[model samples]
Target: MHHAMRQPLPKPTPANLRRFAETPVARKAINTIKDQIAGMRWRIQRRDGNAPAATSDVRIHILAANLDAPNPDDSFRSLTEQVIEDVLVGGWGAVEVQLTSDPQRPLLLWPVDGATIRIYAGWSGDAEEPRYAQVTPWGRHVDLRNDELVYVRLNPRSHTPFGLGRLEVAFETISWLLGAQDYAARLASNTVVQYALWLAEMPPASYDKVISWWQNEIEGTGKVPIIANLPAKPEVLRFGEGSDRDLRLEWQRFLIRIIANAFDLPPLLLGLEQDVNRSTAGPLLEEAFRTAVVPTARLYAEHITREILGRRLGWNDLEFVFEDLEIFDERAQAEIDEILLRNDVLLPDEVRLRRSLPALPGGWGGLTYTQRQMLIGGQRSATGDQ
Candidate 1:
């Protein structure tokens, strides 16, 4: 008989640790973070600082419609959600745009997994253009040019061309938190008890029989009460006098806060609402969106605008814009709108559109009244009152 030599196992690198950190439980947390970021409303707007068109321009409509319906089955919203998820987990998200026979129109927008797509910098004759190689399902590599792929990277490292995900930093803490949860669950399900059984002056055979009976009846079902014959007593003791479970719960919560901080998320956003109240919750929500969600949204917008809409489709002025968060005070917005309307900055129809109301009858809605007229009217009213 002959023995074959065994290959040595590979050392655990940062990439390997990152891959390991993407366990089922970790993936659930990542999804939650991504969902919160992607829940924001997004739209296509002109980069020339003009108002969004009443009727979308033909080029804008085609692009927006394609993004809204990336495929026959998927929408742009869902695609963006997944892209953010990938970017958070792997530090990059990429989408492939397939053009129609007419280069101006896009046929499909397909999301490519960041993990499967390998980016090779300086592969093309142009130093700025990075070549992409996507691994197909059949184990072959499909090369994609820069115009065909929209790649968004987060937190790129100094040396490596690739970006670094937050998971790489928080992996150990998240792993520990998940492990602690599993441990706590196990302890809750299978509580520990110290027991002492005493046999006083009992015969050897009878003692054995009693012990066997106790094992079968009491330990097996956990329903039967401990019973002993004459001169025998069974005592079940509590493991600890202190509240260890409470301490464990506190530790778990502390770990959760650490994980949230690593991802730049508010603990309240992750359902840890202990210290949050009406006053603090609003600020926390705003802070979370401003710090985390807004940056991610901006990254996506810039990449999509420059890569897909600007370069590929030749729509240089077309850009993606996320709607202002609805967390603002309606009263404040109304006051500002009124001022703008009086100053002739915004037409009546513009204000009406903002309020989701139909325009006034005929073209009267488009007329803008000046602040001078308002001031004159106020003077007349004051004189008439006197």
Candidate 2:
């Protein structure tokens, strides 16, 4: 007998990962990371001094406005949300940047489906060179140059041009979870009987009568009392231990935790707070920001700066940044501010500005505590002489 070698199954693609992401726990994990990244406040700043503008260039204003509102159809926040979702599900986020003749809005950004993007071979390590193309639904390929699009990867790999998505990491787990959920749904839909009524020493006609009464009358009625005067007493026989313990819910919960871990999110955010306490909750959120939000936000900002700001527009001095990436701890920030003030690292007016407060009247607010005391002492001495 000749033995036939079996061919290996195809590896999971972005579309397969996206289909798995539609599961409840997987979707929650992806959306949690997406919200954290997309909700951040982004800005364009100069690299030389980190100022709002490097010079009196009109291009800065035009670029800022274009970034704020990519086009009339899409806002920056909405586009970012969709792009981050794509990155989380597909490991790639792409946006086609079309240059417009309008002076006010010179660039129009349209999000390209990451799943449809195909990277061509024979690509050298040139950032400005074109290497990608988009495959249309009708089987047409549209070339996307490197400078014409902003493409970001979640976890870039040297072996392959594609990145590794979080969903891909937990694909098998999510598949098992979905299967378990489907089984539970089947149980809930009365595919299996939980309890059956056994009438001992009853005629066939009487058993049929009782079953008919149950199917026709008792099934749809909401918990109404049943006063049955049957020939034999009915014995209740339970099939298994119980539905609560039989569905393997603990297994499902374990799968949810695995999916959350793959996305670098706390299980609490994915609706699993069983092990969480008050003391750990705050720290868990901070850890999430550090692990999940910061990396993705920084990657997004870097790509925007490199592709859109620097390469496309030739604005090498300007870069993109997300202002609100840090998890804001009011008490910790206040303590740091006090330490800075005591050490004369920051002036009172500078601290006020940092807190978004109006500066104090006159130049007094600019002075440190020691300087203010010395100025008051000099003023008092002059007043005594006068």
Candidate 3:
């Protein structure tokens, strides 16, 4: 007789396993932070492009190919965008690379839930190596090697591999914001100008009758006007003034600015109206990208290059470089490049390469025309022009 086959159990839901740090307030703050950072452009380059080997030069192409298709479904750009967003929101994030059976092309990156993976560091006395222990939703434990994972952390605490996110530090501010919003909503909905009925000589038993009559007559329809019979005229009393509402709004904006400061973001970038003209706005925006976006992008690039590219592929010379943030005039760079070319400080081919143009034919492109003329003269000829 054949034995009955055992059915595999389903994996546990990630939401059930761990609580996320993203509250409604935190999510709003994180989204604002991400919107500013996601627009930055970046690329990977070789450390030494002038190296003598043919295959070594083509390594950039090979690396780009691997990054172009990180997994079956996601591209490197999309994966990086998601990873950055996750890390900013949660403090630390990771992606697991499942190596193929072939030795040539080993890594196949796949997005994994960071909450499921538990990191273990080897103690000083223990001979064991540091490893990642991933517990599946179905309660299966799988150990992973360091090279098999690409991890990114921001502002990590001492003695721990995991990072401490901005959400942890800004928790109190976010809660206050939430509470302020709730109070504003309640004020808007519940506080209204109410009419009080004042009677000259009404009995206690007649109070309920008068209230019921008033409700039926005044609250029934807006089109029809009510003429109530009372001993004295009704008095109008307002619950809150317009100035109080304005103060609440101002306080909320002040709190938002505080939150922006924690993330190192300028209130102007987040669409907060300030007393700034074009002159001041330009400098503030430049400072924002320099202090906030550039540093964060560098952190991401350095970690990925060292952990994934250096260790996994053994391509230590390769690195990820974010393109310079151009908040100033583009024509200024062109003018600077022209000055350098005229002085023979940079070769024509080198200048062309920087502008993404093809090199000129033969070795003539190596020297500028000024240098060529100077060499033809046989002696150093100077007439004000370099």
Find the candidate with the highest TM-score and give its number.
Answer: 2
Index of the highest-lDDT prediction:
2
lDDT of 2 by residue, 1-386 (tens): 00111323235776677677787788888887888777776656567542222334576667778888997888898899888888888788999888888878878899888989888778785866668889887999887777887888989989998887788787877777777777777677767567898888877878877887776666656466474777787677887787577676898899888888889988899898887899999999888888988898898899988898788878788788786665257788789878988776777765554343556778666678788888889999999999
Best-to-worst ranking by TM-score: 2, 3, 1
Expressed as tens digits, the lDDT of each residue in 1-386 for candidate 3 is 00111223223233411222355444555665565555555555666643223223566656557766878788776677677666665566678866576444556877776666788876243324547888887999987777777777778778887775665555556556656676667556644333466654665666776767656766545446455555544444444465566337777778778766766667776567678788888888777777767667778778768877787777798786655544235688778877988886777766554444556766556767696776767545543347
For each candidate in turn, the TM-score is 0.75, 0.78, 0.75
Using alpha carbons, what is the TM-score of model 2?
Answer: 0.78
Q: How far is candidate 2 from the true structure (C-alpha RMSD, Å)?
A: 6.1
TM-score of 1: 0.75
After TM-score superposition, the amount by which residue 233's alpha carbon in candidate 3 deviates from its true location, in angstroms, is: 3.7
The RMSD of every model to the true structure, in order and in angstroms, is 7.0, 6.1, 10.0
Deviating ranges (above 4 Å) for candidate 3: 1-39, 49-56, 101-106, 123-130, 136-140, 191-202, 209-220, 223-227, 243-247, 325-329, 335-360, 363-386
Error of 1 at 374 (Å): 8.8
The positional error of residue 132 in candidate 2, measured at the CA in angstroms, is 0.6
Model 1 lowest lDDT segment of ten: 1-10
